[model samples]
Target: MDEIIRQRIRNSKTLLGPFPNFFYEKTPDYPQALFLEWFQVAVESSVHEPHSMTISTIDQHGSPDSRVLILKDIDNEGWYFASSSQSAKGKQIEINSKVALNFYWSEIGRQVRIRGNAVTMNKERSSKDFLERGKIAKAIALLEKQSLILQDPHELEEALTKQLIKLNRNPKLISPSWTLYKVEATEVEFWQADKERKHIRLQYNLRGEKWVKNLLWP
Candidate 1:
């Protein structure tokens, strides 16, 4: 790499800047309640793609891979997201059920981290989720045979064309292989960026059957 690019990468660690003015002992224990509040704040702050979050999963070899996915639903059950059953992330989840989801709202200077075990939703639910996605998204999902090697660009283009034709014929058609999954969090942490010194950190963990919440020093 060039020296300038290397320097920029090295110096990026210092950009976290001291902390900020706000500090909270904890972000309130209840996961649903606190997350709802944070979500509302993110929405009101005009954060673009607030529902978009990073999902990190580990393969059988224990190597980590991550990709951004939009949150499909959230409630007392768990955080929901969906993908094609054949996608790398979905396959990795099968091998290693452990996963982490992260959210960073740059405009509001806030972040949330969730560590959990994911389980696939039923086919009926998965189909509903897939059908709810926009037509173009459904078309794209149908086009990709993820994690497989491609020998020819024209082959993919041809596949995409055929998929689009099929999709156009029936807009309500859902990808048969698409899967929806929910990550049942074992632990969750909420971090609010601080501009000066101290910051807010709250961690909620599942102990036995009960949820225990704690505040961590930042």
Candidate 2:
């Protein structure tokens, strides 16, 4: 390694990092409360696309795969995300529903980790979600083959254009495999960076019908 590059790596731990600009007690007793609070602050901050997140899944052969996606919605129902059931992530969920979700707001130097099992939303809800999507999104979803290598460079663009026409003919058309899946978080962790490296780590664990808060070593 170059000497200067090595020196830069050595200073990383103490170089860049936050107490957060939002209202947070030194220690939080409520996990969800803290999460929502942080989320709100992140949204209000200068972070671009604060709702963007990375979701990780394990394939059938037990290989890990992850991709960046927008967080569709979140509520008592859980974190909402949509994908084609035949897609790699969806197929992996079909075999093993456990998954991990990560949210990072670099502008605010905050991150959240959620782990839980993914469940497909009911057909009624799923269809409603599909129809509620914007026309272009619906068109893309209509092309159900996600993550597949295209034989022709223009294949997707051509297909999307064709799909748009069919959609225009029948506005109610919906894709069969476009599903909304929810991740019911079993455990959640919130991490906040600190200038002095005394980072804050708070975790919430679900225990038999209740959530328990705990502190973590940074």
Candidate 3:
């Protein structure tokens, strides 16, 4: 069985792409600009869930944990994402503000990695983001028992029904635990894969108010 599994894994192919060329020299002064460009191309290429990314946070035990989440927004303030303050990732962020975000568009053989410190946005912004969510999403967030054990499935349904009714009575209801966080990136790396095994990696590092770009060997 072990030999069979190993053979299966070793036979698998990767980095297969009519991949786009990365002319790192022609990249923008800021990493955000290049990120937006690459993101747009991924969208145009019909990549699935192009806005989805893996967010990694350190747990209380000093271990790494990661999960996939949707990208909310991005700007000079950095990448935006929202979650319940009571959630595992949120609690982890509070303990250690440092985090890492990774965006991989496998179809295009491209990836972007960001290392940064996350900070909570203003209350108004967080509230606005929560209100924009669909009713079901808002109801689930109101429960605020994320990453908790579920003893019974019926309990969830009952709780959700109650929350939905509460929303109907007060459409403006918002969860205080729902928070929007922005990651202020210290370094952003862009990687583009080549069919011939050569890969291009461009990294932008923030130093004193200016961004310094460098090439990394693949």
Best by TM-score: 3
Model 2 spans with C-alpha error above 4 angstroms: 1-30
Query: What clash pairs does model 1 have?
Result: 19-194, 19-195, 19-196, 19-197, 20-194, 20-195, 20-196
Report the C-alpha lDDT of model 1 over 77-189, residue by residue, as the tens digit.
79999998788998899889999999988777788999999989998999898888877678878875877788998988788778889988978777777999999998988
lDDT of 3 by residue, 1-218 (tens): 99999999999989878887788889999999999999999999899999999999999999999999999999977999999889999999999999999999998999999999999998899999999999999999999898889999999999999999999999999999999999999999999998987899999999999999999999
Winner of 1 and 3 under lDDT:
3
TM-score for candidate 2, residues paired by index: 0.88
**Model 2 over residues 61-154: C-alpha lDDT tens digits?**
8999999987878876478898889888889999999999999887677889999999999888889989999999999889987877789979
Residue 70, candidate 2: C-alpha displacement in angstroms: 1.3
Best by lDDT: 3
Weakest lDDT window of 10 consecutive positions for candidate 3: 16-25
Worst 10 residues of 2 by lDDT: 14-23
Question: What Cα-based lDDT does every candidate model obtain?
Answer: 0.83, 0.83, 0.95
Count of residue pairs whose backbone atoms collide, per candidate: 7, 2, 0
